[model samples]
Target: MKFTDGFWLSRPGLTPRYAVEVDDIRVDERAGTMTVYASTTRIEHRGDTLNRALLTVTYSAPAEGVIRVRVQHHSGAVPVVPAFALAADPGFGPGIHVDDEQGILDAGGLSVRVHRTGGWQVDFERDGAPVTHSLARSVAHISGGEGTWMHEQLALGPGERIYGLGERFGALIKNGQTVDSWNADGGTSSEQSYKSIPFYLSSRGYGVLVDSPDHVSFEVGSEVNTRVQFSVPGETLDYHVIAGPTPKDVLRRYTGLTGRPARVPAWSFGLWLTTSFTASYDEGSVTEFIDGMAARDLPLSVFHFDCFWMREYQWTDFEWDPRTFPDPEGQLARLHDRGLRVSAWINPYIAQRSRLFDEARERGYLLRRTDGGVWQWDLWQAGMGIVDFTNPEAAEWYVAHLERLMAQGVDTFKTDFGERIPHEGVVWHDGSDPARMHNYYPFLYNEAVFRALERRYGVGEAVVFARSATVGSQQFPVHWGGDSDSTYLSMAESLRGGLSLALSGFGYWSHDIGGFEGTPDAGLFKRWLAFGLLSSHSRLHGSSSLRVPWAFDEEAVDITRQFTRLKMRLMPYLLGAAEQAHAEGIPMMRPMVLEFPDDRSGFDADAQYMLGDALLVAPVLSADGAVEYYLPEGEWTSLLDGSVQEGRRWVVESHDYDSIPARVRPGTVLPWGAVDDRPEYDWADGVTLRCFQLPDGYDAETTVPGADGTATAFRVRREGARIIASSSDARAAWSLQAGSATATADGAGTLTITIEDNR
Candidate 1:
């Protein structure tokens, strides 16, 4: 994707043609959008124009502060794969004007300038100052044999950092990296990512999203030290420049353009236990694990069955192996009786060994080769053919099988393995280009399954543990970091990837606790247990070995028990934060910078994160149980022991299995739910309101949702002698505990409380 040889010259056999001169400028008759047509070659005379190449430039404003510029070289070439922009109708914004004498096209506050009559240059300026510039040779139409590409170069500051290419495990800051927006099955150790988005937001508060689903190559301060370049192989290049004064504002605007993430169910925040892949598990084994957790006083919510639940090599058959699970219905009913949800593993590919494969082949539901036969491969399964989700009949057939499983007590699905789509010599039912469908296949596949789940289960109750995604895949909740090794290093990398994904408009994210490839040491397991319980969603899954707590050590069980109960008790506050994530585009598991944008110490702190806006969680990544984390200028109290610590300093401490670096910020009113054994109880009943150190005259409010999904707002304001608590909706039964706070109410949804400053 890098076409330049150092700073001055282009690589051999590559012709980069950039727009030089604007031949004409006009406004559309109806839409009134400005269009500028520029020629690639600068013609000297009238006779020299016949052989010169021309690239057309059409610039317009789709919305305020959003400019769309399309550059095309050959008009007769085939349309490119990976269609740009996923939204159905983005609507229109303001008008555009062309000032020929000034040599600039003004699109609202943004301006594009043409320099030297033929040497094309566009400068995006705000208040008569340049924020970013696209020079003459920066925008080029590239050609090499049958493949063509359009490249764009935008200015990058000297020390600005870039972030948010989806689910990347390499670095928290994406400087000096060559990233490819292509989905691959590479594990956590490699540069390849399962969720690759062609959008990056800089520290300077601007973001550029390449509107392509196909592969996009990005050189972030790599090919040129001062510019960030991206190229997509096609006839036209389209991109949007979004402006924000802060990174959170950029995300808000970006998600406004794309779609915001949907709200997941409240119970999904609880701990999930899985039958580890390839591990020997039967009805007895499942019961033992569940009973073991209950015996150890560990709270569990969801029980998942891995691939071995079905017969080997027949994954999509959707039937449990009779030998292992002879009575799946009764078993699931028993688990449900014990107040646990059930999830099963499934993928889109149907193996030849499955009986449904022939039915699909006869129905023309599988992707076909050029010769009109089913495309089969032996990569994961023998003669496995991918379900052609482009075909409506195929989607219906796939959903029918899943609906049968849902009839048998399956609640959710682990929609896995959409990254290995084949792109060569294949055909799609809807006539979509195969190369474009390669990355977009996951979107269609997950949407089909998710919509089917919603049809059976009601809305706000459907969830999927998906692995891969495209632009608009944020609509599907709860994607996990895929395929990591069992080590502390991999745990840190998983956090980095999850934080990156959250920054990319994903509301909820999870990961394999204690990794998925190998059996982690006891230290890693206990550490990961605390980290997983603090996540938006928690699951214990692995390969080869069991992820049962007792397998590691007795302390691991205690660690899991304490954190699981803590998360269950914190559901009132967590679910409120989740509601905010659904309302705004901010992430629940936020990076440090998102919470503390003014704090310079938090910009590079990837090892820790702010759970919502109040709590800071720094998982210990070392074997010694030692962690060094920083808090911004405030008073932070330990959520585990209620010990107070001052901010603006690095604190190093050793912790046992029952404790880690978890703190609640000051001026926080956290609601502790009544039930710790189940997550579906009425959270507002018997809610123990815990108030942290409140600065003088500061006010905080906590809203607790009732069983009917309606929330009651508890307003608390602190004054000199007393604190006042009031309710807006109804008279909710509540109590205040901790810090010697005494309460008295007047029956008009108002209460006055006084607290002594004991601290």
Candidate 2:
């Protein structure tokens, strides 16, 4: 995708054409838009402008603070126009002004100044301060022998860092990196990503989303030292410039344009145990693992069956392999009787070895080759044919298979491997261009299965462990960082990827607890166990070895048990945050910058994150169990030892296997369910509300979500030495306990107490 050899000339077999001069600048005040026409060929006279080639740039506002710029040459339209469309409020119309003398047209905060007979530049600003600018010869419509590309260069300021290219694992800062917005199954070690979104936010408080489902290549300060350049293969390129005063605001505006993530169930927040991929397992193996965890007092909620549950070369048949799982229905009944939910692995690909493949082939439900035959590839499975999600019947067929599994006691699906879609010499059922279908395939595939589950179970109960996603795939509840090696370095990278994805509008994310590629050492496993249990979704999975706690060491089991129970006891607090995620477009797991935008220490603090604006989690990333985390301006209290740590300073600490670094911010009313062993229960029953470091005159409120997603709010305030608690819903009962201080409410539905001491 790199065009230039060095800086002076294009590489071999490449031709570069750039827009040089603006021949004409026309502003239509009535329509509130402007158009600048620039030609690669110089305009000699008025007669020469008739058929001469020109790059037409049009600027318009789709929303109050959103500006869309489209550059085009030919009139031919793209084959597959994506389903993404901007939704905006019409009441706040854009403010447009045109200065003919200065050749500047300003639309809201975006301004474009074109030198009438000289070079053209477009600058986007907020409060008259430049965020990014496109200089002369930066916008180009290039044509090689058989390919056409449109390129643009945006200015990058010093000390500015770019982030959020969709589930990237490389670095927290994307400077000096070349990224491609193409989905690939390259695992977590390489630059390729499973969910590649063409959106990036800069620390300079601005973001750009290239509005294309097709492949987009970005050279972030790499191709040019101080410029972020992106190009796509087409005659036209459309992008949006979103303005924000902070990084979090940029994400709010971005998710407002793209879809926000759906809120997952509260039970999904607990620790999940999976039958590791390719591990030898049967009902006996599963029962032993479950019983072992129970014996160790480790709280486990959801148990997942990996791909081996199905017969070899017959993945996604949606049937439990009779050879190993002879009585899957009864086994699942037994697990449920023991109070556990079940999740099974599934994908959209139908292998030819599967019994349903012939039926699909005969019914024309699979993707077809140019000669009207089914397209088959022998990558993950033998003669696998991808289910054509573009076909309604194919989607129905896929859902029918999942429905059968659901009927057999499957609660959710580990939907995997939609990234390896074929784009060459293939035809879609809806006649969509194959090139665009490569990235969009995951959206339709996950949506089909998710909708089926939602139809069976009501809303707020359906969830999927999805891997690949596109622009709008945030509609799915949970996705995990894919295929990581078992190491400390890989664990840090996985956190980076999750933080990046959360910034991209995903509310919940997960990863393999002990890493997905290899058998982790005991130290790594214990550390990863703590990190995974604290995430929005937790699962223990691996490639070669079993991920049971005892498989690593005895200390691993202890660490896993401690964190699992801690997460289960914290469900009341976490689910309230989940409700907020559904209401607003915020994430349950937030980067430090999202919550503390004014704190300069938070801009690069990827090592720690705020779990829903209250509890801060800093995972032990090294074998020594040493951690250095920052606490913003607050009187933070440790969740483990109940010790207080002052804010606005760095704290260095060492932890054992039984504890990790977790703290609650000041004035936080964290609701805890009475039951510490199970995640899903009457969250409102016997809720023990804990108040942490309530400052004088500070007020806090907590909401407990019912099974139906309705919440009951409880408000509490501190005045001088007295504390008052009240609830709008009188039927709800609550208790307060912080450290040694405990207060119980009478039947009057309000509690009043005077603190004897600041214990």
Candidate 3:
């Protein structure tokens, strides 16, 4: 991907055709496009244009505040499918003007100008100020023995940092990192990502999304030292530069272009206790775990069946293993009777021993090679053939099995193992290029299952605990951090991945509570319990052992109970956050940078995050519970205890399993739910408005999500030393709390509580 050895020398044996100068520029007003023909070599004399290639650079506006730039070497190359799905505004028309000096195109406060007499220069500006631009020799058509590549380099400003390449576990800042858009089943603590998004968000209030599903290599300040270079092996390179005055603005525009995360059900937010991969898959074992949680007063919501639910060496057949699960329908009914949802593990690969494999092979529902043979692999199963979701019949065939499971009362599915898609020696049913289908495969795989769930249930009620994701996979509800080992280090790494995914436009994210591949100690499990319960979604799962909290110690089970109940108590606030995610495309769990863009330390802080816009959650990464976090200048109050910590600096403290470094932002009217046993409840009824340091003359109105997916209005204001809270809905009761002072209203009334100053 790095063509130049340094700044001055090209990599040996690689042929580079740099776009030196623009020969002509053309504009089509109807299409809102500007095409610039740049000569590969500088035009000196009449003979200088004889035997030279020209690079065509096209500029257009997809939506407001978004500009698409496509650099092409050959215009006649065949088009490729399986690209990222973008929903461009149909009636958008950018203001185009070309003078003697430059050509300008403006769309919604963002503009791009192409210098007429410069050495192939294009400058992007916001509000008539410079953001980033392409300099001389930055656009090139690269060729070597590997293949042809279309390359583009954009300059990085001083002190500008990069973030978001999807589920990365390294440093939060992405400077000096070489990343590729290849999805792999790499565990936590590696450069390889399970969900690899071909996008990078700049701290300078902008983002760039490479519009390619094929392998894209990015050299971020690693090769050029001053610019981010990306290359794709093809004739054309298409990308979009989304303008943002803020990082949140950038994500809003980007997710609008791609799809936004769907609204999930309320029960999906509660604690999900799974039969870990090593647990017995019989009904007795399932009942024992479910009964154990209830006996210990641990609030359980969902019970998941892992891979052992199916017969060995057979997957994608969607049949319950008869030896263990003799009555799938009856078992699901029993779990539902206990007020618990059910999720099952599934993937798109069909093993040879699967009952549907031969039918799929005969019906062309599996990917075929160029030699007209089924492409088989033996990594996770015995001779598994990936289902060809590209074929309409194949997708229908695949969803038929899901419909059968839904009839058996499965509420959701864990779509796993999509990162192992083959990129070579394969042909898709729809004639999509194989390389492009590699990352795009997960999109199709998750979409088919998600749509099936939507059809069975309604929209906003379907859920999938998917592991692999692509650029547009955020439309699905939930995605989890994949394959983490059992350790404090892996716990921190999992947090890093979740934070990265939040920046990459995902709304809801979850991870294994006790880690995925190993058994954790009692302390680690208790620590992860606090972190997991605070997440947007919570689940207890492991690889080779049962993940029941009692498996660790009594303290572990107690910790599980306290945190799970705490999350349930916090449901009103969390459900409101989920509504923001569904409406604005913002994530429920946000990175610190998204909350505090002006704070320099926030860009580098990955150890903590803001749960919604109110509370900051710093998971205990050390066994001793020592955690250090940053807070801007404000009055910070702990959500766990009524203790307060002053902000504007670093604070380190040790907490027990009953507590965490969770603090509420100042002047926040946080909604505390009434029920602590189940997540689904009438939120407005019996709610408590916990006012945290309500500043003088503060007024804000917010909504609490209702059970039927509607929002109820709540208003709060601080006048003098009295803080008043009121709601219009007369069907429920509410309360107010300010600095140890508490008052309750019966139904549909106002609660006024006067705070004592320094009493």
Candidate 4:
């Protein structure tokens, strides 16, 4: 996608037509749009414009603090399908003005101004302060070897860092990297990604989203040292610029346009034990694993059956392998009786060897080629034909099978393998462009299943362990990191991907507890156990190997039990964060920069993240149990050991298997649940408000969500030396704890506690 060889030279066979100056600026009052027709070459004379190309640039306001820019070389080409589903307000009227010298379109606090007669340039400002701009020679159309592309480069401020190109496994900061917005099945160690969202957040309190499901390549300070360049094939390139005075504000506006993640179930946040992929598992082994956790005092919530649950090579048949589990219904009932939810693995493909494939092919529910033949591939499964989720009848047919599984006691699904969609020689049932549907297919596939789950289980109760995603796919609740090795390097890389995805507006994310590809060492497994259980969702899974705690060692089992119980106790705080994600777009597991935007030292801290708004979790990534992390300006109290650490500096801590850097932020009234056995219960019942280092005159309100979506508010304030806590809905028991002192309240009352050892 790079067209320039260096600073002043163009690559061979490349014809670059750069926008020189604006010739005409047209304002559409009703549409809230400003269209600028720019001559690709300088038009000094009237005859010079006769044969020159004119690039059309249009800017429109979609929502408050959001502006969409569309650049086109030829306007006659048909618009592409499978575009992002943007939520634009129709009645929003932007302030627009055009003059002979300059034109401006203001959308809320963000405005874009065009230089009418000067060298083609558009400056974007946040409340009259310059943020970025499309500078000279930054917009161009390049044609080479019968293919044309349109690209736009935006200026990057000094020390500005970019993040979130969708679950990236490389460095957390995206500076000096070339990223392509194409989904792939690449593992955690590679540059390719399973979820490639065409959006990036800046440390400078702004974000950009390229509006294309097709292949969009981005050169973040890579192609040009001072600009971020994005290009797409064919005539048009559309993108959105979101303004934010803070990273949280940027995500709020961005997710408002695409979609916010839904609220997942409470049990989904608990410890999940999965039958590892390609491992030897049946009713006996499964029962043994479930019973083993209980025997070891490990509080488990969900049990997942991986791909081998179905017959070999018959992925979408949705049938439990009779030879392995002749009674899936009764088996699932036994797990439910043990207080566990069930998740089954499924994909959007039908192997030809299965009976469902012929049925789907006959019913025209499979993707077809232009030659009128069914599209088949031998990648994951032999002769596997993808289910055409675009067709209404086809989606219904697919969901019918999922519904049947639901009837058999399946509570959720792990929607996998949507990244390998074929874009060549395939025809979509909805007549969408195949190239555009490549990345977008996952959205439709997961949507069909998620909507069905919601129909059956009700809203805020459905969950999916989906692996692939694109624009607007955050509406589906839970997604996990795909294939990863059982090494500390892969563990660190997976954290980078999850942190990146969290910044991309995803609320809930999970990964394999002990990695996915191979068996992890005891140290690695025990270390990852703390990290995984502390996530929004936790799952223990692997490939061809059991991820049971005993698979590593006895210490692993003890560590797993300890973290599982700890996570159960932290449900009240985590559930409140989930509710916030549903109401706004902020993620539960937040990057350091998102939580502390003013702390420049924490901008590049990816290994550690803020779990909800109170706790900071720094996972131990080394076998030696040594971890380095940065804390912003505050007094951080370790939730694990109750130790104190002063803020505003980097700290290295060595932890045992049962501990990590799980610290509570200063000035936080964290709601702690009394129960430590299960995730679902009366969350406000016996809740303890743990007040951490309350400075004088500090007051805040904290809310804890019930299992059934009910929320209760608790008011905490510090007056002199006493910390007082009061509840709004005190139908159940509550308490307040400051250091060693504790005070209790039965119902509709207030409790006060005094701290003796806050230091």
* TM-scores of all predicted structures: 0.95, 0.94, 0.99, 0.99
Better of 2 and 4 by TM-score: 4
Q: Model 4 over residues 214-293: C-alpha lDDT tens digits?
A: 99999999989999999999999899999998999999999999999998878888888999999999999999999899
Which portions of model 2 miss their true places by more than 4 Å? 5-9, 26-32, 41-52, 82-93, 102-118, 746-748, 752-759
Best by lDDT: 4
What C-alpha lDDT, on a 0 to 100 scale, does residue 534 get in candidate 4? 93
lDDT by residue (189-295, candidate 3, tens digit) is: 78899999999898999999999989999999888878999999988999999988998999999999999999999899999988888656588889999999999
What are the runs in model 3 whose C-alpha is more than 4 Å off?
A: none
Deviation of model 2 at 686, angstroms: 3.0
Residue 317, candidate 3: C-alpha displacement in angstroms = 1.9
Clashes in each model (backbone N, CA, C under 3 Å)? 1, 0, 0, 0
CA lDDT scores, all candidates in order: 0.82, 0.83, 0.90, 0.91
| Clashes by residue pair, model 3 | none
User: Lowest summed-lDDT stretch of 10 residues in model 3?
Assistant: 750-759
Error of model 3, residue 160, in angstroms? 0.6
Error of 1 at 346 (Å): 0.2
